[model samples]
Target: MFKKIAILHISLPIDQVYDYLEKRYNSTLYADASEQTKGYMPKIEIREATKNSFLSFYVKGHDPFTGLSVGSWKWSYTLTQEAGGMTKLKIAYEYGLFMSFISGGTVGHQAANEICETALALDALSNAQLAQ
Candidate 1:
């Protein structure tokens, strides 16, 4: 199993960020998949939390690379309110080898880097919006 993790301090409400990701990252976004994940439909499951103020989801789908057909994938996201009106988010993903075809080295590394950039950018956008 391969994993990637990212943390960000966002200037957005924790509930708002959580709600946005719960739909965007979870299987809900695939309701209208674009060619990339067509044949393999993923299942999204959410874990409700109150004590930790955290939300987690799991998606099961076919890995396009190893031809393994499909497997279960889990994504855990932690959100905590910081002292300075910012939300701390911790995002982690565990991937199966079946989908390694997207990137094993050059492509995968670049893709993950871009994803990290997007996360930072999203936080920036939140800051900008709040400023406005």
Candidate 2:
């Protein structure tokens, strides 16, 4: 099993970020016409949550780099209200990997890197929107 966690602090309010993610869940996240073109975009199935500030979903898809089936796992995102009206976005990912030539440790590293990159991208978007 490979597990990774990424946290990002967005300047936007928690409600705003929560609404943004909820909207994305309703629509296709990648918006690709084909799965091949979608590449690493995981098929996400939203799960239940007690609060609007928290979201959970399942993800199953090919490894972003190797195109190998990585099985399925639960991904949870928590948006916590923070000081200055900022939001602390925490993303946790846990998934199982099929046996392959690649080591599980390597896969975990790659997954962590991808998570960090994704967090940075999201933070950038939040900053941009806040600036506007």
Candidate 3:
């Protein structure tokens, strides 16, 4: 099995970050992945989180390698108010692969790096949002 985790700490409030996620990545990716849930989607669900300080959801890998037969995954996040006029967003993603995919951590590290790229984009987006 291959496991990877990625996270980002944005300066925006938890609510604003959640809204950006819903408008940006949710429609194209998360919505399709979360077809099982109606009305409540990835970021929207964050509004109803048990703790107002955090938001979390999971998404599976659909890479050409894992394909359709592989298992699903969890990508959770927590947003917190920082001490020095900033906000922190923490993200975690985990995936388990088998057979040829589990041969090494090279692919897994690459996948994690890709996840980090996504997180970085989110950080940029938050910065833009804050600037506006």
Estimate every model's Cα lDDT from 0 to 1.
0.64, 0.69, 0.56
Query: What TM-score quantifies how close candidate 2 is to the native fold?
Result: 0.69
TM-score of 3: 0.57
Clashing pairs in 3: 9-89
What does candidate 2 score in Cα RMSD to the true structure?
Answer: 3.9
The regions of model 3 sitting more than 4 angstroms off are 1-3, 28-52, 60-67, 97-107
Q: Please report the candidate that would top lDDT against the real structure.
A: 2
TM-scores for all candidates?
0.63, 0.69, 0.57
**Which tens-of-lDDT digit does each residue in 23-48 have in candidate 3?**
55557565765555333343333333
Task: Give the least accurate 10-residue stretch of model 3, judged by summed lDDT.
Answer: 39-48
Q: Encode model 1's per-residue lDDT on 1-132: one tens digit a residue.
A: 777787788887777766666666444444656335455555567865443367666655555656453555566778898876678888777666755544444434633674586486567669787788
Q: Higher-TM-score candidate among 1 and 2?
A: 2
Off by over 4 Å in 1: 25-30, 33-41, 48-52, 63-68, 96-121, 124-128
Clashing residue pairs in candidate 1 (N, C-alpha, C atoms within 3 angstroms)? none
Ranking of predictions according to lDDT? 2, 1, 3
